[model samples]
Target: MSEDLQETGAGDRPGPVTATATPTVTDTTAATGRAYGGADPVPAASTAHVAGAGRALRGAATGGGRARRAMGRGRGRHRRTGRVTATDDRPATFRDVFGVAEYRALFGAAVLSWVGDYFAKVAVAFLVFSNTGSVLLSAIGFAISYLPWVAGGPVLAALAERYPYRRVMIICDVARMVMVGLMALPATPLPVLLLLLLGASLLTPPFQAARSAMVAQLLTGDRYVVGLSFQNMAGQSAQVAGYALGGVVAAIDPHAALVINAATYAASTLLLWRGVRPRPLPVVHTERRSLLRETFDGLGFVFGHRVMRPTAMVVFSVVGIIIVPEGLAAAWAPSFGGGSQVTGLLMAAPPIGAVLGAVVTRMTGPERRLRLLRPLLLAAPLLLVPVLAAPPFAVAFALVLLAAAAVNTVLVPLNGLFVQMLPNAYRARAFGIMQGGIQLTHAVAVLVAGALAERLPVPLVIGAWAVCGLLLMAVSVTTWPSRQVIAEEVARAAELNRAPEPEAPAPMPARPPVPAQPAMPARQPVPAQQVLPVPAQHAASQPVTT
Candidate 1:
């Protein structure tokens, strides 16, 4: 069952909307209405039978007036289950998403958390270096925060599905608050301080996973996509702010910066505990599973499902190559005989382009944005082809900026489509898998690109890698799923949201015993009262037979 709500534009203007119910296929024939391998046409009588069955299925799923009543409430607030609200037409403005009370709280919490995380990153490096007088130890302290995400992120994120989202977030925040506060202590030893920081960092994966999963609940349709873009913008802004403030505070006293980080976590904890509503675990599986098993299940789901597989490949491939520019900026600038300021400019170029790209994409309507996805993917690597000649610093900056913009443009729609294809129960787990993959790929790309630059010019290495990226994108485009396939996946997701709880099995009726004869084929059961008729044309095109 599904319901669609269309908004004419951004504001208060009313628009005509239509709603419908759709079903997912349980078997091959159910979806296409054709035999597994045969081309035999379905009889007209069977077509009517299938149509009738569809109507019955819709009735059963909606439960008469109950599902409609739940939707009328607007927020789907009354329903405690994982049901998704209908997709809304028109792009959501900043006002539309931020207007929701829950989203406002989540957004604020994210801003605070991001700022605090960056602050701690800078402060810890300073603290470690100050105490140990070792640059290596200081670097390790800074890098430790990322290690947990690479090694244990999926396992940690699986924990989020075992408990309420609100609880997971609040607990993680509180734990981090205490740990960072301890790290701020004047007499804490460097070794112990690093250990405490590592402990705190371990909680970040599940905390982040919980927050990401909740975003889908707070905003629906295009608003969800827009919300994610806003998140990227916020993170970029926060990183800049945190680094600036952290330097000044650490100059005065590194402890002060650590204290500030602790305070931010405390504030985040309070915001989440008070602002976000408690939600039940989204997964409905009754059987028990280990965390490792659950993590692999998520990995399999992402790579195994057809729609998700292509989407994930596109994201991983694009990011794996485009991210080399930022990671190599420090080495690349000095090789050109440029100073610190030049390096800074090179470092800031990509995020600035990304922010602009996100803003532009957000303003465009969803359909147009999607239409641009393939073009942007193709443009990204092509833009970098000019770097093969080792252009001037200024020229290189412009090229990198343009390529970054194209990559960011592709990300917005692809992420939205990814979220649309995901089932509610798998949101957190899938997010964990994708995030982990991104971090791993970016790290590997940087290491490889850096090593290659030692033997060749930095420009040559970057250009050659991008050429490979273009080939990867070509293959991705060739294998990309059709629009119809994506639409069907989206429709099936909506149907899952509206699905009713499974009914208890009916008791078997008593019958007189019959003499055993040759075994007979068992017939599939049909819910006669619930089935709807299929159209003649549709039935002929796609036939269903038991």
Candidate 2:
């Protein structure tokens, strides 16, 4: 039994004392009856005992029950041992994520691919402009990479579930290598070049989906969030590296840059084929549904689920608005008497800020990051509102960098939450859907912003659009799901993922056959007649007795 005694003093006389006796391993609370560390309460009984002279005098000086209650408020109690426990508040580290070999390989492959992609984008844009001499065609070429996502990204991503992840990635890489190599040839027509680019871009969604699904498999728990941060950081760094070098390389010769891009794809394919292990597809052959059905199902699942619905809304809205700055950079920079050099710097600012934001977010714990989500969303568009004043190029650049940082801060936590909310089986399709939405939003934002900039000052167009974004954010914040709801969903999803998969049933044993019974012979009439003799004396005696 466990006992807690309370002594109260009133003048020289002690107030009625109380003693609570609880069974061993049962919870005990203070006189105030509040729970400590999620423990259950036990009943208390009043008891009187005379104290020695010294003890009585000491008891009369201090208020005992009230002091004990104050001390127990924040302490956690062990359910089994009834002991107080302290909470651990340490932050996560990069070692927690990058130490895994699989993640390292995936991360390396992604970096090579991202850098190659950006390089090719710049080269293709330069080639289109040089050949056609039309800015519109160049913009269209730049936009074509994103167009495939809007057209059939989800359907293509569903293919990831139908094949091995390694195979999907390698095939996509090889296809891109061949397509980019064709584009590098001098005799390739402009129309054919554009078509090849679109065809190569069409394979991107499945490749990315395969990579994402593999990530979910490689990293678990808190490491998943940290891994995602690292991936985002690497991608941003690659963009900076690729764009800076692409500009320099294209100046020498655009064809050379295209050739280099094709080489990167070949290198990426080799790396993935050698370094990454092959894994079975997420959906088994017997269990697989049609691509269209799965695509629609993924869409329905994201929009119809309560937690995911709000998360999707928040991510899409924030991304749609934040991307506008980079999307409009080409037109926005020229307005300030700057050429391609200024445009490249403006384009690079957001990704640099994004890299910084990822590093900062990596140092924070999950709970703290989630708490910052709404605040960061509100800050992003508000930060961009200053562009309304028509600040100088340098001032506008700083403002945009800050705004991009805030937007990235929101994304890190939001993405972690969304991934946690999804079932593991649907991760690829869901990722494809989310990524496609981001690409489509970005494409539309750039096109619309560029068109509006033609009729108005670039600063005015960006600021007015930002103001509209702020209103949209307000609605998103107002409708944001409560933390408790999201936590419950995350916990439930985690539980489902942790549950072991059911094993196939064992086959039954075969049984032996029974022997057949023999048949009986029929009686003969001649044998019956031979046995039918009777005595005359016995018959006459029986008749007289009757």
Best by lDDT: 1
lDDT of 1 by residue, 1-546 (tens): 000111100111111111432443211112112211123122111222334355555655869565444334333211342122222124568998798899999899989988888888998999888878999989999999998888988889888888888899999999999999999999988888889989999999999898988887777656776787778877888888888898888878988888998999999988988888887877667886999999999999889987789888889888887898888888789767898888888888888878878797678655446546667787899888888998999899998988988888778667766776678778899988888888888889999999998898888888998999998987777666643455455556655555366888998998889978988899768775654467888876666543
lDDT by residue (1-546, candidate 2, tens digit) is 001101100000011122233311101112112111223243221111111223444554586654444334323344484332332112346897778887777788888888888888898899999998999999899889878799989889988877888899999999999999999898989999899999999999999998988887776545766677778888888887898898789877888888988998898888888878887765555676789999999999999987788778878887888888888888888777899988988988898779878887777654345445566777899888889998888998998888888888767656755776677668888989998888778778887888898899888988998899999887777665543354345445544445355887988777666777687688545643243344776764454310
Candidate 1 wrongly placed segments (more than 4 Å): 1-20, 23-89, 499-546
C-alpha TM-scores of all predictions: 0.77, 0.74
Which parts of model 2 are misplaced by more than 4 Å? Answer: 1-89, 285-289, 334-341, 499-546
TM-score of 2: 0.74
Residue 347 lDDT, candidate 1, scale 0-100: 80
Task: Write down the RMSD of all candidates, one decimal each.
Answer: 19.1, 14.9
- What C-alpha lDDT do the candidate models reach, one value each? 0.73, 0.71
